[model samples]
Target: MSDITLPSTPNKLSRYEITGYILIAAGAIVLFWGIIMFDLVTLIATGANEEVGIVFGEFGEFIGGIVGSLWALAGVFLFFATLTYQKREFELQRIELHKTQKIFQQQNFSTLYISFLNKHNDIINSLTAYDINKSEWSGTNFFVFFQEKVLSSFTQKVRTKEESAKTPELLHSFFKDYFIYHFSFYQTSLNPYLKNLSVLIKLIQRYRAETQDAGEYYSFITKAGFTQSELFLIYHVARYQLLVEFHNIDHAFDVFEDLKDELKVDRIVQQELNDENYL
Candidate 1:
């Protein structure tokens, strides 16, 4: 195979530098023509090889009159040009500083977010609960159990109730009563998890507002390596807006929709997820 090497692209400042060099070269050529070449022309016009002193006097006068004025104008132009160039440099520096601060902010957010996610994972790993039968469940299995067994039963029990939560406020009350109070152990373990999710969501949301990242933060959550069980648990958390009175688990909806395929399997759960209160 033939070697292929493309030339490096020049930056805007380098192009400006090249232009300055060309201007300097042109100015040097003009200076040589005015000072030395013009004196030779004067000598030729006089046709007086012995009258060198008069030619020298005329040369000195020409320099004093024309070249001095040219230098003065050039100096003024150079002064302004220097100011403009310095202004451009300072503007470029300001842009770089803003970018650096933004990158630093994102880095800090990412570190905090990942730490929260790890803490989220840690919370999941930290799960432990006992059902009504005193049967043991832990971690992902516990959520799977809660989703398949507990939440399922609760919906079935509430299905025919005329008072079943149909509004956001009612649903909040419903979740607290049926889920939080009844399954105290689960909610206990779930407290820190929900709290962490709320903080993470708000962090992303605030970042979204400041940076206009536009759904990028949601990608981080979806791709944060959530298990099916963890997503299932989170969906219900958003569904009822659990712990939302104090924090922002409401933003979990962003994560839930990104992983909504998992929510489609159960009809009642699916309907509830699509409910205006939830969606």
Candidate 2:
């Protein structure tokens, strides 16, 4: 197998990368305004517009959201350029990846992996969810809804539970039961995507152990270009202990803030979950 070239620290800025930097500048400006704007913007009114006062009162939210969303877009722009560069850089490895086909399958494993990556959003597109008001959502809106309505609510639910009740065993069962009952279709659609992620990670580990060619093959797996919601879902999936094929997923998380917190379960509960006799 070829030494799969990882993304090096990019030296040249692409057009979008430049745009992203400009947006960073814009966001800094907006953030400054967000800090002082309630007083500054209102003071500019000079009681002339009076601005309904309530309208001016929302300067903070308006400005803050603009700044926050601005930064998110900037990051996306930068990430796109990085992905573009990495794609070109990894061309050799993709060809060499054909050698693994005998093990992964008889067909071209490189094309197979790329196809799986391409279909990720298609799976996300197939995922349907109803918001609190029964509004059907898919695609990007689906991720936002899941993060805001689903994960946020689940986080609060965990907070409400006693520490002793915070075990992976209980949480896993709870989420499985709840999601199966409510988001059964969503669950069904997401399995292939998640399974692919687990498979890709395991494949990288297998390649590493066998080849001993220390290259960043993991980035090939990370090329799925996870949306924030997708990342959160992966983290939660592992936390809930739902994925049996999943391995080496922890490395994909980039040491998320709640990485340890999610697994902080009661010792007795931990023992129980490990005991196959109880299962």
Q: What would the per-residue lDDT of candidate 1 be over residues 3-49, giving only the tens digit for each residue? A: 22433333544444555555556555666766676566657776576
What TM-score would you give candidate 1 relative to the actual structure? 0.60
Give the per-residue lDDT digits (tens) of candidate 2, residues 1-279. 454454454677888899999999999988776657566655675655566456556775786579778889999999998888878667646655755654564234456556666676576677677876889888766756665555444455656778766778665565554443434446676777777767666665565565554554455445446665665566656655667764446664342443233223332234434556433
TM-score list, all predictions: 0.60, 0.42
Per-residue lDDT, model 1, residue 73, is 58
Which candidate number has the best TM-score? 1
Q: Candidate 2 at residue 84, lDDT?
A: 81
lDDT (C-alpha) at residue 195 in model 1: 79
Give the deviation of candidate 2 from the true structure as CA RMSD.
31.4
